[model samples]
Target chain A: MAALAPLSTYALRLGDDALILGQRLSEWCGHAPTIEVDLSLANLALDLIGQATHFLGVAGDADKLAFHRDALDFSNCLLVEQPNGDFAQTMARQFLFSTFQELHLHALASSKDERFAAIAAKAVKEVAYHRQLSSDWVVRLGDGTEESRARMTAGLDWMWRFVDELFQMDELEAKLAKGGAGVDKSELRAEWDRRVDAVLAEATLARPASRRPVLGGRRGHHTEHLGPLLSQMQFLQRAYPGAVW
Target chain B: MQDWPLWEVFIRAKGGLSHRHAGSVHAADAKMALEHARDTYTRRMEGVSLWVIPSAQIISSDPADAGPLFEPAEDKIYRHPTFYSIPDHIKHI
Candidate 1:
């Protein structure tokens, strides 16, 4: 077992996940395939950003944590930091992450920490909509034209490697889970698989073969992609420290 | 795709309200259309209920015939209920 980290660390991890993903989704604001899709992606981005604010607020100053952190200090899962490849790829990322987040939020709703429970309880509802929107797109694209089916397959393959990391248990989370203040994410894997598998089956798409899990985001280690993302995200803050609207 | 059909969206603001046309969305099917309507029109908690119908399915009277279709009803003053004496309890009427 590794040394226990503070409870704020746990909150920061969750916040980073939401913040980074929200930022990624916001990249689609004017670029989505359709106006409706653009609106929907923006809405999802707003919801995730709202969640991040609450979680990061619990950890400390939300603005400082969000704007001041370097790429190495961000504990968000690597899945979120991946570039939004295309529409299908974006939906695939959304499908996989939202499914896991909905379940995680559901579990956290029962947390012993009232603050965590309150945030999770409210966020779970928004995440449910995110899950539905993503899964529906997965099914539509997967079961549509041959070209669409092909793109959907490639999208899932691109994202499959990161699935395992979402459920990986770490020492900090383990200690918090033991105290009923956090979730034992590993326990949610079975249900995540069931839900994801159902969507794949309905989409008429095959599950991507499991590969060696990509790990280390929880420990502040990340793929090459996160650096550019952090650079872009932190620019306004770094350029003018303490600048505000 | 550009080939997707247009869907007219209707939103019911509350329990007792009738769904009114809010706007339109483009989608491949009814299910997708409904979701599109929800995302497009109801993001601000504007509605408790929603309805989406294929724009092609809606039948509209030809504008050229507007005089024959509706002008005759404009002169019917008896259709108005203003002559009725309302009791104090009948606030809604």
Candidate 2:
């Protein structure tokens, strides 16, 4: 196997995260509880897909990288690939992930590597809106009626274990950070915690207890959910290579 | 399952322009109402700004009294700016 550059891997990791989460959000296209909610979700999905395209484009041919990669070769974090359990669950995943992503991109916008910096600069604004959408939902569901509160809590529970993995820095990330091409994830945790905690407080929701961190998605190990997601997402390209609409 | 209140959405296509009624959406609160308005109305870049007012709060004149409300104004040509011609040199009047 040809060894991939650390920077390329980093770009792919972020790209895959956006692509997978966008795919998950796309599942809500026709199924969201309300037409407004459906439009919001779809818009957010489009934003993520746009981000994915830019990130993957920087790494290589965006379409080929997205459609042809095997599941084992993808670098998205496990948190993004988790099934959208319910509205609350989906919101929880989105809130947690977008919060982290926004913070990370803010730091990456100042990266020494101009390419990473440029991409991150553009993505930061889009992720800001995404973060707002998720955060609002989190507050609403958390402070809402008994059923919504319970569902929101359960959703947080479903996602909390994966939170730690987002801040875990492997050698590649550490090297990139040292070279100013990547963010030091550890530095982002405190701010992420502050923003999340404040929102949870306002929503009258308690933070979930910490558990064993589920790691390895950055290293290509993912939950079973990703296989089916990739199959559905990549179907057109796989079935009809080079076909253009 | 609870239905939210309806909000009337207005959009200003550009800066320094009055907001015109665009559409309406249902939301539980003011913030959500604004969000829904943006999601629903601004997808095509139709406006630079938005206003969301609760539909119930707006009092409209009775359409049955249309003649009394507007018919008299229809013939008030003197009130029309177009009644006077501006000098060509007064450009953009």
lDDT score for residue A209 of model 1: 96
Instruction: Give the distance in Å from residue B82's predicted Cα in candidate 1 to where it truly belongs.
Output: 2.1
The candidate 1 chain A region of ten consecutive residues with least summed lDDT is A1-10
DockQ of each: 0.81, 0.74
Worst 10 residues of 2 chain A by lDDT: A1-10
At residue A213, give the lDDT of candidate 2: 88
User: Which ranges in model 1 have alpha carbons more than 4 Å from their true place?
Assistant: A1-5, B84-92
lDDT by residue (A117-219, candidate 1, tens digit) is 9999999999999999999999999999999999999999999899999999888789999999999999999999999999999999999998988999988
Query: Per-candidate TM vs. native?
Result: 0.96, 0.96
Which stretches of model 2 miss by more than 4 angstroms?
B81-91
lDDT of 2 at B83: 69
lDDT of 2 by residue, A1-245 (tens): 25678888899989999999999999999999888889999998998999999889888888999999889888899999999999999999999999999999999999998988998899898889888988999999999999999999999999999999999998999999998899899999999999999999988999999898899898889989999999999999999999898
- Candidate 1, residue A47: lDDT: 98
